[model samples]
Target chain A: MSHQSKRIILKSFPQGHPKESDFEINTIEIKEDEVKDGQVLVKLLYVSVDPYLRYRMKQVDNKAFQGYKLNEPLTSICLARVISSKHGSLKEGDNVTSWNLTWQEFSIVKGEELNKLPSNDLPLSYYLHSLGMTGFTAYFGLLSVGEPKEGETVLVSAAAGAVGMLVGQIAKLKGCKALGIAGGKEKVEFVKSLGFDDCLDYKTVDNMDEAIKKFCPNGIDVYFDNVGSETLDAVLLNINDGARLPLCGSISNYNDTKEAQGPRRTFNLISKNAKMEGFLVSKYGKDFGKAQQEITEWLKQGKIKEQIDERNGMEKIVPSFIDLFHGRNTGKVVVKIADE
Target chain B: MSHQSKRIILKSFPQGHPKESDFEINTIEIKEDEVKDGQVLVKLLYVSVDPYLRYRMKQVDNKAFQGYKLNEPLTSICLARVISSKHGSLKEGDNVTSWNLTWQEFSIVKGEELNKLPSNDLPLSYYLHSLGMTGFTAYFGLLSVGEPKEGETVLVSAAAGAVGMLVGQIAKLKGCKALGIAGGKEKVEFVKSLGFDDCLDYKTVDNMDEAIKKFCPNGIDVYFDNVGSETLDAVLLNINDGARLPLCGSISNYNDTKEAQGPRRTFNLISKNAKMEGFLVSKYGKDFGKAQQEITEWLKQGKIKEQIDERNGMEKIVPSFIDLFHGRNTGKVVVKIADE
Candidate 1:
C-alpha cells in the first residue's frame, strides 16, 4: 500500500526576512513496503518552529550550521509515534522524539537515533521544548557561561521567548535579581507573571541604556543576550565592572542584509574589565543528560515554568514560523500536525 | 638652600592629539628644608613615558585611571637615587623605583612607599620597563586571561611596544606560535628579531584581514590586542572557535574626539564561541611579586629581550611622551633626566 504525505519544502533562499513564498507545500506518495530494514516510519504529531530556523533559511555555507537546501524538506525537532517498525528496538505505537525529522506528516528515521520518551503525566509537546534543546541551551548559557551569582543583577533580552524565559527563571532561582527586556507591554506582563523581578518594554522605551540603568541601578552583572543589536549595545553601556555577557543568539541581526554599524563598545569592556563570550548549546553535548535531568527535576518541582504558543494543523506552520521573527509569539512556537 | 626643579605640567587638556602647548614647563623652587618627616628627596634618573598617559590626558573622569591635574607635575614610574632621607628606611645614594615620581629632576616621595631595587647587573632603566609594570601587564594579560595553549597561534598588536614585546617573547616561551602586528617595516623587523614567527606591518597592509588569514592559516587562538580600531575589526572576522582575546589597551581611540564607529562584530564572537576580556595590570597587585620573579628569571636567562628608546634630558620628556602617540618610538619610551 502507498500513502500520500504532505510536506513543506524550501522553495527559495531568503535575502532578508522569510516569506510564505519561500516555502511550498508538496504531496508525495511513499510505499510502506519500501521502508529500509533499520528504519521506522514515524507519524509526526508536533513540529517545533524556532527563531534559529531563520538563519538556516539564508543560503550560506556555515560549517557550524548548514542552511537548508532548496527543493528539500526542512527538518527540525519533532514529536512522533511509530506507525510501522522494521528495527529490533522500535515497534508500532511507540512514542519518540528525534531531531532528524522532516516537515512531512510522515518520516522514515533510523530506530537507533530515536529517543524513546518516558510515559509521564506532562504533555508530550514539552519534550519538543522545555525538556529539549531550548532547555539545554538555557541551562548551559546561563549557568556555565553567564555564571550568575547570588544578589547579582541578571538581564535577559527577548524575555518572552523560550530560552530567555528559562534564563530569567533560572537566574531568579539562583537568587539573582532577574530583569527581562521584551518587545511589547503584553510580553512584559507575561514575563513578569513568569516571576521575573521586573520587565522592560523595549518597544516603548525612548532610550534603552537609560532604561536599563534605571532598572538595574547596580549595573548588569550578567547579561544573557539573545537579541544582539541595539539591546546589546544598551546593556554594554550600563554594565558593572567584571560583567559577564553570554552571547547566545543575535536574532536582531539575522535578517540584516548589510553589516551592522554601532558605537564601538570594546573600550567599555576594557575599562570595566568585563568579559563577553559567545556559545552554542551543541558545545555541551557530552553533558546534555545531566542538564536534562536537572531541568526535568526543576520542572517537576515547579521551580521552572514552560509556555507554548501552539497553532493547529500543519498548514499553519509557515505563518506560525513567520510570526516568530515578528515577535508575535509569547513563548515556544509549535505547530500541531496531528493528535497523538 | 632651595633647588629649582623644572617640571612638566598640563597647561590644558587636548581635544584630540596632544600638542606641546598643552604642556608647560614650570621651574618651581623647592625649599629642601620643607621636606616632610615621612618624605625623602630623590633625584629622578629615568622617568617612564607610557601610552596610558594619553588616556590620563583626557578631561573625562575614569574610575579605573585618573587624569593628571592641571598646573601640577605629571607623575609616572621613575628610577631615582635617594639624595636625602627624612624617615627610617631610605638613605642617601640608595637607588629606588617609585610610581610617585614626577617628570622633574627631583621629587619628594614617602620613604616607605619606595621599592628598593636589589643591586643587579641589569641596567637601572630596566627597573622602569621590563621588571616593572610593563612586564607584569604582559604576564597577567597573556598567561592569566589569554591562557594560550602550546601550538596555538598567538597574535600581539603594537608588537614593538614595551608590553607587546614581552607578550610575544612569553608566548613563544610557552610553546605557542607568536605573530606580531606592528606599524612600520622597522617595527616589523624589530619584533621579528625578538623570535616572533612573523610580523605584519599594519600600515603597509591594505587588507589586514587577508594578511592575518595568510599568516595565521588555522586562525588566531589568542589575540593580545593593544591598538584597538580597524585592526581589531579585521581580526574579528578570522578568529577560530573558542578564541581568547585579552583586551589590554586601545591606544587607537585614546585621541578620538568622538565615539568610534565600526562594524558591530559581536555577532562574529557569537558564531565562533569566542571570549574577549579586558583587564588592568593593577588588578594583579597581590600576585605582582610572583610575576616579577618569573619575568626577572626569564630576563636573566636571555629568554626575554628588552628594548629602550632613551631620550636625553628632562626637557625632552614632553616630546618623548608625545612621540608615543605618533608611533615614532620602537620600544619603551623613557627620558634620561640624570645619571647616578
Candidate 2:
C-alpha cells in the first residue's frame, strides 16, 4: 500500500519580505516500505507557524541558526500522531511532538527524535504553544535574562504575540509591574486581559518616549525587547539607572533589505550604566525541563492563559506562516493538518 | 599681598560643539586674609582636561554626571601646591591632588578635600595620567566589565586617548591580542608604538567593516568602545560569539546637537549572543587603591607607558579643551598652570 503526502518547499530566498511565490506545495508518494526499522510514519496534527521562520527564508552567512537549504522541505515544530511504527519505542496511535519534523501532512521520522506525550486534560494543540517552544522562550528570556525584580517595571514588545504574552504573565506572577507595547488596539486589549498592568498600542501612540514615561513612572527596569525599532530607541531614553534589556527577537527588522536605522544607543547605555544582552532559547536547553514543569503547574492552577489561532488543513500552512509577518494573528499561529 | 587668579567660567551651555566664546576668563583678586579656619589657599600646578568635560557643558536633566552650572567657575581634577593653611594638617608647600579644584591658577579649598601625595620617584604628571583616574578606568572597564580571556582578541577605540591606551596594554598583559582604532596616522603610529598588536587609523580607512575584518582575523572578543559612531557599527558586525563590549565613552557623539545616527545593532548582539554594558569609573572607587598599586608596579617595570599632551599656561586651557574634540592631542591633555 502507498500514500500521497503534501509538503511545503522553498522555491526561492526572499530579498526583503517573503511572499507566496517563495514557496511551493509539492505532493510526493510515500510507500509503506519506506518506514525503516528505527523510523515511525507520522501524520502531522498541528504545525507551528513562528516569526523565526522569516529569518530562515533569507540566504545569509553567519546566521545565528543554520538557514534552511534551498529546494528542501521546510521543517518546524509539529504535533503529530504515529500512524505506524517499526521502532521499539513508538507505536500506532501514539501522540508525539517533534522539533525536527517536516511541514507536511505525513513525515517519516526516527522514533528517537519524537517525544510521546502523556495524556493530559489540556487540548492537544496546547503542546504547539503555551506548553511548547513559545512558552519556553518567554520563560528563560524573562526570568533568567531580564531578571525582573519584585518591584521593578517590566516592559515587553509584541505583547500580543506568543512569547510576549507569557513574558508579561510571568512578570506579573513574580510581583513586577508588567507593561506591554503591541501594534493595535485589539492587541492592546488582548494583552491587558492577560493581566498586564498597562498595554500601549504602538500604532496609535504619538510619542513612545512620552507614553512610556507616563505609563512607567519609575522608568523601565527590565525591558524584554521583541520588536526592535523605534520602541527600543524610546525605551533607551527612559531606562532607569542600571537597567537590563534582554534582546529576545527583532520581528520589526526580519524583513529589512538593509540594516535598520535608529539613534545610536551606546551613549545612553553608558550614561545609565545599563546592560543589553542578546540571547536565543536554545542557550537554555539544559533547563527546559524545569521551565516546562513550572509552566504546566501555572496552567493547571488557572494562573496562566494560552491563546491559539488555528487554521485547518496543510494547504493553509503558507498563509498561516505569511500571516505572522503582518501581525495578522494574535498569540500562537498553528496549522492543523489532521485529527490526532 | 593679594593674588589675581584667572579662572574659566561657563558662559553658556553649548548647542552642539563647544566654542571658545562659551567660556569666559575672569580675573578675580583673592585677598591674603581670605584663608580661614580649616581652609587652604593652593596654587594649581596641573589641571586635567578630559573628554567627559564636554558632556558637562550641556544643560540636560538625568545627566550621568552633573553638568557645570552656567556663569560659575569650572572645576576639575588638579595637582596643586598648598601655599598656606589654617588647618591642623601642617601643609605649607605640600604637594597634593584635589578632584574639586577650580580650573585656575589659584584655588581656595577646604583642607580636608586634598590628598597629600607621598614622595615618589615618578614624575608629578604621572599622578595625573598613568597613576590616576585614567589608569583606574582602564583597569576596571577592561578587566572587570570586558573580562577578556587569554588568547582572545581585544579591540579598543580612541586608542591614542588616556583610557584606551591603558586598556590595550592591560589586555596585552592578560595574554589577549590587543588591537586599536585611532583617528590620524600619527595617532595610529603612537598606539602601535605602545605594543598594540595592530592599529587602524579610522580617519584614513575607506571601509571600517573591512578594516576590522582584516585586523581581527579571529573576530573581536572584547571591545572597549570610546568613540561610538561608524567604528562601533563596524565592530558590531565582526564580533565573535559571546563578545563583550564595555562602553567607556562616546566622544564622537558628545559634540552632536542631535543624537548620533547609526545602524541599530540589537539584532547583531542577539545573533552573536553578545553583551554590552556601560559604566562610570566612579563605580569602582572602593577598589582604586588596589588598581593604583598594580598600575604603579606596571609603570615601574616599563610594561606600561603614559603619553602626556601638555599645554603651557592657564590661558591655553580653553584651546586645549577644544582640541580634544578635533583629535588634535593624544593621551592625557593637561594644562600646566604653574610650576610643580
Candidate that scores best on TM-score: 1
TM-score of structure candidate 2: 0.95
For each candidate in turn, the TM-score is 0.97, 0.95
Going through the candidates in the order shown, the clash numbers are: 0, 0
Candidate 1 residue pairs in clash (backbone atoms < 3 Å): none
lDDT (Cα, tens digit) per residue for candidate 2, span B1-340: 6899999999999888788999999899877688999999889999888888888877877467677999999988889998999878848898888766898777778999988886778888877887888888899999999999999999999999988999999999999999999988899999999999989888878998898888888899999999888888889899998999999988888889877785466577888888889888888889988998898899889999889988888788889988988989889888888886
lDDT of 1 by residue, B252-324 (tens): 8888999877436767787788988999888889998888788788989999999988998877988888888
Candidate 1: stretches off by over 4 Å = none
By how many angstroms RMSD does model 2 differ from the true structure?
2.1
Which residue window of length 10 is worst by lDDT in model 2 chain B? B258-267
